[model samples]
Target: MTITIDGLSIKKKEDFYANIKTELNVPEYFGNNLDALYDILTEHPDRLQIKFLHYDRMCAQLGVPFCQKLLKVLQDADILTIINQH
Candidate 1:
């Protein structure tokens, strides 16, 4: 089953993005495979720390490894995560 970052069905994604954007000082991008995209978020130490804190504090967040897991299962993964999203 493919999942989307927005598909998490939380109170609101705007809240999540707000925190991540504030924490990293960068705008967060939304995509179907949020798990895979996590790497881009955590590639840097400062960014990773910010993201981890956001996960523990504001919401139960997932990281990049899970994204890789999902990426493997997806056939249209590129379209859903990379091309179609941007």
Candidate 2:
């Protein structure tokens, strides 16, 4: 799957952060700060499937439409495809 920002998929920040961490065999990103996470995302926009457990809830509280920023699927041949807004 693909995340699009203005048809570019750049606005989905949280999703990208999670994808890279997971792909790199690092621990799942867990923090209370979205701004910090957003900053991290700015560094890598190619990765998909990031952790946004807190951001989702906050978006719900703020009446913001939080789309599926992070997603992962095991396709054929053990392929792990992480999709984020990009």
Candidate 3:
């Protein structure tokens, strides 16, 4: 499955997590945190392709440090294909 997230729409951390939870159809019990995201994506049953548009803008909004952490989690997830478009 493929999911596209527009970085411009993400105003805060919660927006990003909300987008992931909704798009990925994670259970209600899912924790909205980087560790939980990594656990879920790594164990996901289906191959997932996640595309981030305006990645640079997201970094500008969320700060480079946080985006770097988020990117690390996504990169470490074996079952996911992450694409970033600036």
Q: Tell me each candidate's RMSD, in Å, in order.
A: 12.4, 12.1, 1.6
Per-residue lDDT of model 1, residues 19-46, tens digit only? 4354445534544344533544445333
lDDT of 3 by residue, 1-86 (tens): 98988998998888998999999888898897899999889886688888889888888888999988987887788545555666
Clashing pairs in 3: none
Name the top lDDT candidate. 3
Instruction: Rank all candidate structures by their TM-score, best first, as comma-separated numbers.
Output: 3, 1, 2
Give per-residue lDDT, candidate 2, residue 13. 41
Worst 10 residues of 1 by lDDT: 47-56
TM-scores for the candidates: 0.31, 0.24, 0.88
- Tell me how candidate 1 scores on lDDT: 0.37
TM-score of 1: 0.31
User: What lDDT does each candidate get?
Assistant: 0.37, 0.36, 0.85
- Backbone clash tally for model 2? 6
Model 2 spans with C-alpha error above 4 angstroms: 1-30, 47-86
* lDDT of candidate 2 over 19-86, digit per residue (tens): 44444434355442344444444444454433333444434433343332222122211223333322
> Candidate 2 has which clashing residue pairs, if any?
3-85, 3-86, 4-9, 5-9, 18-50, 19-49
